[model samples]
Target chain A: MHALSLPTWWIHVASVLEWMLAMVAVIRWGERRGETEWRWLALAMLPALVSAMAACTWHLFDNPIELQGLVVFQAGTTLLGNVALAAAAWTLLPERSQS
Target chain B: MTVVGLGALAAVDPSPLFVLSLLPYLAFLRWAAASKRFPPLALRGFQFTLVFVAVTIAAAVVAELRFGQQLADVDRLHGSAEAFLTVANLLVLWGFSRAEPGQEPPDPEASTTGPSGEQVLSTGVEPAVPPEDGASVLDPE
Candidate 1:
C-alpha cells in the first residue's frame, strides 16, 4: 500500500485484473468454439495469477523482512506457470492442425 | 525449530528460479513459431513475456547493485518491469479473441443453417444453439 506509489499500485492492480480477464476471455472463446481443451489453458493461468497475487501481498505488507517467504513463493509459482502454459499451448496444437 | 527452518528457506535467493523459467518459455516459443495454426499475435505476446522476465532481472540487479535495495523497494524499476507484463497480457488477450475456429480466413460458404434456421458460421463467431440453463459461465452465448 504505502510502500508503493499511486501509479505503481495502479499498474499492479491493473495487471492482475487484465490477467484474470485474459483467462476468462480465453476460456470463453474456447467454449464458444467447442474446444474443451482450452480449459487447460485457463487452468494453467492460475499459477501465474497466484504469483501476481503473492507479489502484491508482499508489497502490501511493505516488503517486510518477515514476509520474505512470499518472494520465494512467487518465484516458484512463476516457474510453474511458465511450464504449465507451455504444456497447455501444446495441447491446443493437435486439434488446431485437424481443423 | 520449525520457524527457524522456514526462515532459513525463505532467505534463500529466489532469483535462480526466475532464470530457470526461461528454458520452458523458450521451448514454448519454438512450438508457437512452428505452428501455422497458432494465433500469431498470441505467439508474439508469449514472446514478449520473455522480455518481461529479462527486464525484471535487469531491474533487480540494478536495484541491488546501484541502490542497495530490492526491486520491490524501488518503485520505478518494479513498475516498469510490470508494465511489460501488462502489455504482454493484453496482446495475448487480443490475439486469442481474434482467433477463430480453424484459424483460416473466413469463407462465405462456411456458414451453415442450424435446426432453428439461424446461421452458424464455421468461423466460430456464432453458436449453433443457445446455451441452456446451468451451463458454465465460460459458455459465451
Candidate 2:
C-alpha cells in the first residue's frame, strides 16, 4: 500500500475545520430564525467530524492506498451530513415574500 | 465508456468538470431561496438526486482506488468530492421545497360586531335604518 501524501492529510484537516465552521453558522442561523430544529442539523456534523478525524489519522499513520476505501466512505457520509445541514438552513431561514 | 471519458478529461485537466458538476447545486440553492411555494415532493426529489449522486461518486472513487493503476489519468478523488457537494446541495433544495410555513395569526374584526339596534335604543340614541331595495327611508320616492 502506498503512503498517504501531505496533501491528503491537509484536505482531511481542512474538511474538519470547514465542517466545524458550518456547524456554528447553522446553529446561529437557526437561533435567529427561532427554529428548534437547528440542533439536529448541528448534531449531524458530528459524524462527519469523527470521520474526518479517523481518515486523517489513517492517512497520516497507515497505508494511504488501503485507506482509500475509508476515505470514500467518509466522503459519502459527509454528503449526507451536508444535506442535513442544508435542510436545517432552509428550515431556519426566512422565506421570500409572496408578493 | 463513460468512465473513460471522465478519465480522459481528468488527465487533461480536472478542475473544469469538477466546477461544472457543482453548478447544479449552486443553482438549486438559488432557486430554493427565491421560490415562494415550497412543494414537498420537489424537495424530496432533490434530496434523492443528491444522495444518488453522492453514492455514485463514492462508488466511482472506490472503483478507481481498486484500479488506479489502470485509470491513472483519472482524478477520481477530486471528482468524487465535487459530486458529493453537488448532491448535497440538491438535497438542501429538496428539504427547502418540503418545508411548511408557520401558522398564521388569526384575523381581527372577525369576532366583534358594532353595537346592535336594541343596545342603541337602550342608550336612548335613535338607530338609523337603511331603505330596503328601491324604497328610500327619507322619502318614499
Candidate 3:
C-alpha cells in the first residue's frame, strides 16, 4: 500500500495558485459592482487549501496506512471544491448574458 | 521500506474510487466552461482542468484494467498522470491570468431605450433609499 504522492501536492499547489489568481480578478471586479458571486468563487478553493494542508501533515508522519484513511478526506475536499465551483458558476447565471 | 518514502520517490497514484467520483464533477465543469455569463478565461482555465483530470482518470482506468498494477507499469502510469496534471495546472494558471480585471460581463439584454429615449433599469440596481423626512417619494413636487 502506498501513502500520499507528489502529484497530490502538485495539484494542491497549482490549485492554490490558480485560486489566488482568480481571486485577484474577482476581487477587482466584485468590489466595484457589489457582486457576491466572488465570495462563492473564493469559497470554492476551500477544499484545495484543506487538501494541501493534509498532504503536508501526511508528509510529516509518512504513514501509508494513515494515508489510506486520509484519501477519503482528500476526496471529500475535492468534492467540496468542485461543488463550490459549480455553485459559483450557477450564481453567475451564464444564461443572463446580453452581449 | 516506507510507502510514504516510496510515494515521495514516486507520485500520487489514482485510485478507482477517486477517478469515478470525479465523473459527475467533470460533467459539471464541462457545462460551466460552456456558460456565457462568466469570463471566458476563467471558464477556459476550468476547461483545461477538466481535460487534464479526465485524461488522468482515463489513464488510471486503463492501467488498472490492463496492467494490473504491476510495479513498473504503475510507476509509468502514475508518472504519466502527474505529467498531465502538471500541464493541466499550468493551463489553469495561464487561462485565469488572461482575464482582465474589473471588466463587467456584458449583459445580453443591454439597457433598453424607451420611446422617449429614457433608459430601462439595469440589473443589480441599488435599493431605494428610505425617506429621511418620512415623505413619500411618489408625491410630485
Candidate 4:
C-alpha cells in the first residue's frame, strides 16, 4: 500500500489532539457567560470524548459486525455532541442582562 | 475518525458506508448554519466540512487507483481524512473561542406597565381604598 503506517499513526494522534483542543475551546467560550453555560459546554463534550475514544480504539476490532457497531456509535456521538453545542450556543445569547 | 474508517471498512468500498456515517455530522452542520447565532462561524464550518469530505473522497479514490482495493490502504486514507476534518473542526472552534457574545441590556424606558404606572393593569382602572368611616367604596355599575 502506498499509504505508510507511521504517517497514518501521526495523523490519528493529531486528530485526537485537535479534538481535545476543540473541546477545551468550546468550554472556555461558554464559560465566559457563567458557570451554567460552562456546565452545558461540559455536557456537550462528553459525547465527543467518547467518539474520540472510539476512534482511537477502532483498530482493535477485527469482526465486521463490531466495526459496524463502532461506526454507528461514532455517528451518534458526533450528532449528540454537535446538537449539544448548538443548544449551548443558544443558551449563551448575546446581550442578556446578568441575573 | 475511527467511525469514518470503520464505516468504510464495513463495506468493501469506502463511499457508501463512510457517507452514511458522515450524514449525521452533515445534518448537524446544516442546523448550526441555519441557527444564525454565529453566521460567520457557521459559514466557515460549512466550508471546512465540504473541504474535509471532498479531500477524503479524493484521497480514497487515489489510494484505490494506486494500491487496489485493500482494507489497510482504505484505512490509511480514512486516517488522513479524519486528520483533515479534525483540523478543520479545530479551526472552527478557534474562531468560535475568539468571539465575544455580549449580554443584552434591559431597556429602561420600556416600562412594564402602560405609559402611566398608576393604573391597575388587571382591572383596567385605578385601585379603590376604603376609608375608616363606613364610607361606600367606588361601587361601579
Candidate 5:
C-alpha cells in the first residue's frame, strides 16, 4: 500500500475492475447469443484475475521479503491463465475451421 | 552445496513461466486471427494482452538492471505495465458488451411469408412491384 504511489494503486485497481467487467460482458454476450462456450472464456479469465489480485496484494503489503513467494504464484497463475484463454478461444472456432 | 533462498529463487526464476506462457498466447493469437466469427475488437483486445506482457517483461528487466529492484517494488514501472493491461481489459469489455447484430430478438410484428405466398404480419406493407423493364424499382437508372 505505502510502497505504491496513489496513481499506481489506481491503475492496479482499475485493471482488476476492468478485467472482471470484461468477464461478465463475455458471459452476457454468450448467453444472449445462445452460445454456451463463451462461458468458458469467462472462466478462463479467472486465473489472470487471480494473478492480478495476488500482485496487488503483494504490493498492498509493501512487497515484504517474507511474502515474495506471491511473485512466483502470480507468474504461475499468469501462465495458466494464458493457456486457458488460448484453449477457450480455440474451442470457439468451428470444428471445420480448427486446424 | 550452494544454499539458495527458495523465495528469492522463485522470484527470480519466474522467467521460465513467462517464457512458457508465450507459447499458448501465440497459439491463441493464431486461432483468433483465423476465425471469421470471432469478434474483431475482442481479437485486438487479446493482442493487447501480449503487448502488456511484453511491456511488463521489459519493465521487469529494467527494474532489475537499473534499480536492482523487482518490478513490484518499482512503482512507476509497475504502474505503466499495468496500464496496458487495463487498456486490454477495456477493449475486451467494449467488444463483448455491445449487442451483436445477429443477436437481436426477432420482432413479432415483422413480416413473414405464408404458405399461400401471402405476407403474414399484424401491420403489413404491400410487396414492392417490379418494374416492367425487369429492373428493381429502387435501382437508380
Candidate 6:
C-alpha cells in the first residue's frame, strides 16, 4: 500500500466538510420553509459523509483500493443521494394537474 | 476493476461540469412544479439555448487550455457536442417546466367590486341609485 499524500488527505477532508455543510444547510432550510421533502433530501448527505469517512480510513490505513465494505457502503449512499435529490425536486416543484 | 470502469465511463468521463450545469434547469423544474405555474415552453427553450451557448464557449476555453493547439479538431468537436447537449438538456427542461398547469388570470368581474356602499361608478353611467343602500340594491338577490 502506498502512503497517503497531504493533498489527497486535504481533498478528502474538504469533501467531507462540504457535504456536512450541505446537509446542515438543507435541513435548516427545510425546517424554515416547513418542507418535509427538503428535510428528507438532507439525508442524502449521510452517504456522502460515509463515503468521505471510508476514504479517510483507507488513506489512514495506506490502502489505495477501497475495500468491498467501503464500496458497498458508498454505492448505497450514492443511490440514496440520487433518490433524495429527485424526491426533493418533486416536492419543491410544481406538478401537472390531472384532468 | 469493474467499479473503477463504471466510475470513469459512466460518471467521470462525460464532463461533470455539464451535469452540474443542469442544476439550474433541475431547480427551475422543481420550482415550477411545486408552484403549479407553467411558463411557455418556447420561452424556456430560448433561455436554455442561451445558457447552452454560454457553456459551450466556456468549455471551448477549457479544452483549448488543456489540449493546447495540438487537438484543434478535438476541441471543436468537444465544444460542438457540449453545445448540442446543453441545448438538448434545455429543451428537455423546458418541456418539463411546461408539463405543469399554468395559473389563470383573476376574473375581471371578481375584482371590480368595491367595499362599502360606493358603487363602482363607470364612465357615462348616471348615479342611478342612492349610496346608502347601493350594495343591497346591487346585490343579485
Tell me the DockQ of each model, to 2 decimals: 0.47, 0.03, 0.19, 0.19, 0.47, 0.07
Task: Extract clashing residue pairs from model 4.
Answer: A95-B102, A95-B103, A95-B104, A96-B103, A96-B104
Q: lDDT tens digits, residues B49-121, model 1?
A: 8888789889999999999998889999989888898899888888877766545334332222112222244
Clashes of each: 0, 1, 6, 5, 1, 7
- Cand. 4 TM to true fold: 0.55
Error of 1 at B121 (Å): 3.2
Docking verdict class for candidate 3: incorrect
TM-score of chain B of each: 0.66, 0.35, 0.45, 0.48, 0.63, 0.31
Compared with the true structure, what per-residue lDDT tens digits does model 3 show for residues A1-99? 133356654544565565566566555444433455666666665666676465445544653443544555565567666776666666655454322
Q: What lDDT does each candidate get? A: 0.75, 0.44, 0.53, 0.54, 0.74, 0.44
Residue-wise C-alpha lDDT for candidate 6, range A3-95, written one tens digit per residue: 434544444454455456556655654443333555655564465467546545644655433343444444455445545554555554433
Candidate 4 Cα lDDT to native: 0.54
Candidate 1's C-alpha runs over 4 A off are A95-99, B1-8, B102-119, B122-141
Q: Which residues of candidate 4, in runs, are more than 4 Å off?
A: A1-4, A34-42, A60-69, A79-99, B1-24, B39-47, B70-80, B101-141
Give DockQ: model 1.
0.47
Model 6: residues with Cα > 4 Å off, grouped in runs: A64-68, A96-99, B1-141
Q: With candidate 6 superimposed using the best TM-score fit, by how many Å does residue A20's alpha carbon deviate from the native?
A: 0.8
What tens-digit string does per-residue lDDT give for candidate 4 at B92-123? 67555665432212323222211332222224
Q: Which 10-residue window in model 3 chain A sums to the lowest lDDT?
A: A1-10
lDDT tens digits, residue span A1-99, model 2:
134344444444554565566556545534433445657656865665665665555455453443444544454445555555455445534342211
- Recovered share of real interface contacts in candidate 4: 0.26
The best candidate in terms of lDDT: 1
Model 2 C-alpha lDDT versus the unseen true structure: 0.44
The residue-level lDDT of candidate 4 at A80 comes to 69
Chain B fold agreement for model 6, TM-score: 0.31
Worst lDDT run of 10 residues, candidate 4 chain A, spans A90-99
Candidate 3 lDDT, tens digit per residue, B31-120?
Answer: 565554355655666666667676666776877788875222354565565555456555555544544332325542322211211121
Per-residue lDDT of model 4, residues A19-72, tens digit only: 667667656644443334555645765786787676555544432454655655
